[model samples]
Target chain A: MLSMQKVSFRYGKNTDYVLSGVDADFVPGKFYTVFGPSGSGKTTCLSLLGGLDTPTAGEVLLDGISLRQIGGEELRRKHVSYIFQNYMLFPYMSAVQNVVTAIEISGKGGREAKQEAEKVLLSLGIEEKDMYRKVRKLSGGQQQRVAIARSVATGSRYILADEPTGNLDKKNAQMIIDIFLRLVREQEKCLVVVTHSQQVRDASDIRYELTDGQLSLWGEAAEYAEF
Target chain B: MRNFSTIAKRAFRTISGKWKGYALLLLVVAAITLTLYIFFFWLDASARLATQARTSTEACILLQSNDRQQIGSLPQAMREHPAVKGSDTTTLLTASPVNFVNAVSRQDSPFDLPGESDQVLVSAHTDIAMSDAFRTGNASLVEGAFPTGSDPQVVIEDVLAKRNGLQIGDSISMSLSLPGYTEPHQLNLRVCGIYHLQQPIEATYYTSDGTPVYGASPYSSVFVPFDTLAVRFPDALSQDSVCFYLTDFTAISSVLEQFRQLNPDPARYTLSDFTDYRYEQLLQASQAVGRLILAAVWIFIGMELLILFFAILSILRSYYKDAGILIALGERRRCVAAQFLFQILVVGVVAVSVTLVGAFLLTPLLATLASGQIVHTAAETLPGNAVEIGAIENMARLLEEHGGNFAMLYASIAVLSVLVLLGLSSFFLFSHTPTRRLFDKE
Candidate 1:
């Protein structure tokens, strides 16, 4: 679970604000959806939640511990798995290789890491036939699936998906939504899906929309929302 | 702790990935290496030549003058001085017009007086005083046997033998003239044996002037017993002039002072030392080659650094998005720098390994190209013969025998430079490029 209070950020002190006065909370064992217009700071929110940036003002807490207080990259590799909007799969790698990247990044040993990558892809219902194919040859939906598998493979408690279904077709999007809902409910991992897609909003258990720099819960009080 | 294989594997991966880099690096390295080889090989050979020149039994002192009456007193004085390891006195008689039958040009020039060899060599003990005439492997009798038991047998230098249509047991004519005489007086002597010398001095020979002459020559050395030479023309040797030889080769100036006080003729006589010998000249020439090698090495290494830095920068730019993603994923600046650092090491190891293997493999072929023998010659000191293509092979062999010292020094320097390269690359990475390098971090 992650929580943020009055989180405001500007790229530089004198530059116009990129995010400002944002207060939000992300709960574990829940599928949380983040929706916003373009430049609405949803990406910034997700990055903050995953410990990618320092807010100009406000605090972000993960499992009651502030993400800002931890040592940077190692902590992220240890606790958070991120899926970028454009699906940042390791390009020279295969589908399984993409999944194994996170494991290697986390400094887990190799033989066991590959097995772990296989387990994640298998659980996502990606076929073994496509596992060895390089990521560039795979379809966008397949690439997104590989990214999701990598995020899951590391067994991190937090999953920050930046527009996970943004580039997918309706069928792939619905399938991905279903996978998130199942992982959040059963595995009890924090799944924060940042997207503006109405279908993702419609399927999520809770939704928060970022307007300007602030987030407001628009749901039926999926409230335990503010820590 | 990983030995050869692990390092080699890492090197192989980098080479396979960046074939052009490997090729460019090797091209420059090979050219530089060959240049260094020529240089270092010369140095090694010349260095060995120095030691051999120092260690060999050579003429330590030679005194030449035209006056036989005054120099005859040299034996008594020289024998009294300490540090007289050994001494050899020879009578070098000069004249003109040998008058050989079927001769190329009945040249009336030096070496017309064929002096007695034993009288010329009688100053020192035969065991120690005998000049190293030539390598014995090249000595064999084509007609009769070598001159034995002082039977008045004569041997001529190979050039003289080839010049005149003379055979063993054949007779030859010679002449000797004094200052008072306008024309040379002639005498005939029988030839007995022929020999060649390893020394590259001008091919010359000697003779019996009106007075016995003591010296060396090209096509000019003739041997006769001291008794035979004395019976024919007896005279004491001249020693009015003086050339100095100190106990140590380096003390020429101080020893020159001593020789001046002892013999007192500075104009005609001069101090001779190691530097004046054939050895030092070869060494200087080799060092000149080494300087060229050192310059080439510096240029090559500088080029390598420039190329490597630019190449790495381009690679980093190509992966700008990757850097952004890593930064967004919370990778610290240090980790990003380390990855690139590892990448360059991978390349360095591959390139260096290829060079080492290629150098070792091609070394023998290079050696073959440089096949000159280690023939020590007096002409190594003479002008027009300091270095030449004809003797490069011999020079190379001598260089090879002494190259281990140079190799150790060069390799150590190379390794140190590589380490410094690592530090410089890392410094460049850390100080010049930060992980927040690209503006598009999302």
Candidate 2:
């Protein structure tokens, strides 16, 4: 389990807090989403969860141990993986190579790593032919699938995604949500997604809303009521 | 946790994918290398020439003594001097009778033949074959060999041999007039060798009617073994001169002072300073030029390194997005830095290899070009001496020896420059910036 305890964050000393007193719990075998307005710190919350940034005032812990004690790099490498909105695959590498690179970075490398990467990509609906093409040459849907496959191939327990289906079409977005549901139901992996899509929120098991540096359960929030 | 081969493969891929940028860097590094190599070659050649010109026999001093005992002892004394590298002694023989049988005669002959017949009068004002004149390249042996040891042998001039149809192993008779002897001592000597003067001596003789007749043909006297001459004419009047080669030309004044301490009387022991001031000035000028070239090479290296730093910085900056992606994929920051460093090193090694091969292939041509320029300048400004020209000719060999050292130096500097650039860029780009900010599209 990964949880945030009264976490607060600001860009710098002079800047106002982007996330204040934020609290959340993520467990395996569940898919969750955080929705908010443009400046509601949804991405900042995901960054903290993924160990990309440190909390200002509180603790982000994995299995009751503080992230600082676990070390950010080790936590990210062994416990969590992130998927960005832009499908931030290495532009020069093919889809399979990107997943293999992620696997290599996670310290699970060898000739077997390539077979594992191909298996993961094929399971994610990427064809064998498209897997060898440079990511830039792949479609938006295919590139997002490659990014998700990279997260899955690393075998991290928690997959933190920021707007995973933001650039895909409606049909492609639905397909990605289905893939996330299958990952949670079949692989028993935790999925924490920061998104504003109604399709993603409907597919998730639980939802949270971030507003004015605060996070609250979706149905109980005043913003959700207004929406 | 990436291994070296994995990181190197990624670096190689990145370099090949972005070859245009790396190619530009390679060209810049190659240009700097070529410029630096040319300057190094010039400095090396100039320094060697300067040293050669400085220590040559042109910087020697001559010590002449008319005192018979002092003349005999001054050579051994000068040879034992600490400052002297070597010494050569010459004894000028005068009015020795030389008779040639059945010789050819010309109208402009300086020698008065008997009754205009084929008998030639040869006045052998000879010196030793190993005298200062021959040692200094004033004359060279054309046929046979120099008289070695005391063999009662002589090497006549080429013109004298040609005029008299003389061949080697022919007998020549000379009489030395010893002091307090009514009769001259006759000695029969064999012609063992012949030599030609580098610069022929002009002859002016008076006819019987007091008209001066100039000879169109050049003439020079004979050479004999000094030991034989000294043994045969023990009491003959001889002017003795000693040439002293100093170990250090800069200490010529001190060496001259040492010589004066040995022979204090100026009238009996006259010192002729034959040190070539022009050659010394040229040496100084060459040294100054060498220093200037070295300075320019260093400045060029400094400026090129600055350019390299910025070039690598720009390259790293362009790769910031890729680095962020790698880091976000859980790659260690140090691994990313190593990958980038490997990329730069790959390009650097290729550039250095290309430059070295190019330089190796072109060294002989460059050396020839440099030698030609130095030889032309030396011939114009310096005397036509064999030692100076030989030194100029040695530039090719020196360049070959120094070229290897220069290549090694260039390789070291190039690799060090690349490493420094990588270090500075990594510090600026990776150490100070956050990974999120690096890949942040906005």
Candidate 3:
């Protein structure tokens, strides 16, 4: 479980707040979608959940323990994995090699890591022939599948994806959403995905919206009330 | 091991994929290493040559007699001194044959002897300054070779030979005259060689009345083997002081000081250590040249390092994204640095190895460059007003004998410089910027 308590954040001293008095809870085996318009603090909340940045005030907790106490880099390595919207794959490496690198980084080693990478890519609907191609040569849908494969290959408890389907077409975006749902429903991985797509928001187990640096539920008049 | 291989493989792939940038780096490293090796080798060679020249050669100490009377117990006293007894000393009977050998002065002779009563001087071969002059081309045998052993042979001066019409194999008669003897002893010696002198000779002996009478040197003198003189005219010879030949020239000053304490009378005799003084001057000059070479080498090294530092900074700036990706993948900062260092070391080793081979092939050219300066320094220390090429050749030969010292020094310096440049350049780059910021750049 990942939880935030009265977290506040600003980029620098004297800059306007990107997030203030924000509180939320995330549990395993559920898919949560965070939706907001441009500059609405949605990505800021996702960055915090991924352990990429720390809140200026309050605490972010993981499994009832503070993420800061666990060390941000160690937290990302052991418990959280981040997938960027544009599929940040090493351009020079093939799909399998990219997945293998991620597995090795997560402390896995040897021929077993390579085999596991191959298995993960194959399960994500990447053909054996396409799996050996460089990520740059892959189609947009295939590239998204490889990125999804890389995040899941780590087997971390929580996956924080920032606009994972923002650069994809409707069909490729739906395929990525299917992968996220399968991870939560079958693999019992807690996932927090930030996006502006209504289809993605409706498909998630729960929905939250951000406005004026504050977080609220998608529906109900009291949801947008100040804390 | 697995983790390290992973990073190393990544670095290798990255370097190989973009070989152009790495090729430029390799070229710079090679140029630096080659120039440094040449300078370091020359410095080592010059220093070793200087030291060998300073200490190994023989130094001669000539002792001139104070009076015409027979040498007393002073010769024995000098032999007992620690400095004299510790060295190889050969005492010779040096005298003027003026009273015995009658000759007329030649028109072109430099000496101004009285008319109609001119005489020649004779000395037994002592194997000190005479041999040095012959070896350095200060005097050359114009006819036959130098007389050796106890042969009743003589080497006449060229001017006297020409004036007297004397030729090789001609017997010259000399009547030895002495005090209180009504009969004069006569001896005949065959002329073996005639020599020409290149420098003005300052005659050391005087006439019967204390007036200094200069001789015509090689032009109006005769030289025979010391053993022949001692055997044929034992009563005519005087052995006052001996010439002490020291094996190590650098010890001459100390030995001279020690000898003075033993003798206590500087005016009673004259000591000449010109050979030792000459070597000392040469040693000092060569050392100065060595210092200059080292200074030049270090300045080039500093310039090369600065170029390498900035070049590496620019390359690392390009590598920021790669470094950031590694950091984001949970690699430790040291691991990322190690990966970069491994890449640099690969290039360094290649450059150094190439330089080593290149230096080997260029040894002759490098030796010539080093020898030219060394020869100039060595020649300046010679007795002549100008540096002689013969002396330079002799110095070059000495340097060649000790060439291995230069190679060892060059190897050590090359390895040290490569390691230092790689370590410092990488460490400085990593310490200045945060890896996290690199990862977030689009």
Best by TM-score: 2
Cα displacement (angstroms), candidate 3, residue B419, comes to: 4.9
Q: Give candidate 1's whole-model lDDT.
A: 0.56
Instruction: Record all residue pairs in model 3 with backbone atoms less than 3 Å apart, i.e. clashing.
Output: none
Per-residue alpha-carbon lDDT of candidate 3 for residues B1-442, written as tens digits (9 for 90 to 100) = 9879887777786677546667777777777777677666676666666665655455656555544331334444445444442422333222111122222234333233345235456555544224434544666788887776355888877876776678898887765443333465566788888888777444444464634555544324566665565566655554334455554666678767765775577777666674634445556666767778788878888888787767666657656656665555555667777778887778778877787777766765666666676557656655453444554566665554445346635664666466566656665665433433422221
TM-score of chain A of each: 0.93, 0.95, 0.95
lDDT value, candidate 2, whole model = 0.71
Which is the better candidate, 1 or 2, if ranked by DockQ? 2
**Candidate 3 lDDT, tens digit per residue, A42-161?**
877866876667899988999889878886667766788777776777766789888887788788877998899999999999999998887889988898789888888988888887
Name the better of 1 and 3 by lDDT.
3
* Error of model 3, residue B133, in angstroms: 14
Q: TM-score of each candidate? A: 0.65, 0.78, 0.66
Ranking by lDDT: 2, 3, 1
Best candidate, lDDT-wise? 2
What tens digits encode model 1's per-residue C-alpha lDDT throughout B1-442? 2223322432343344446654654454444444444445545655565564443322245455554442445444554334332343321111100111111112452233244122111111111112233221333334444445444445566655665666788876555332333454343556776656444322222333323323443223444333333333333211233332323344445544544566676554444433334444444444554465567767866775576556655555544455555544445555555554555555544545555566555555545443322222323434564544434554555545556346434643464365347535654555333323322133
DockQ result, candidate 3: 0.17
Specify the CAPRI tier of model 2: acceptable
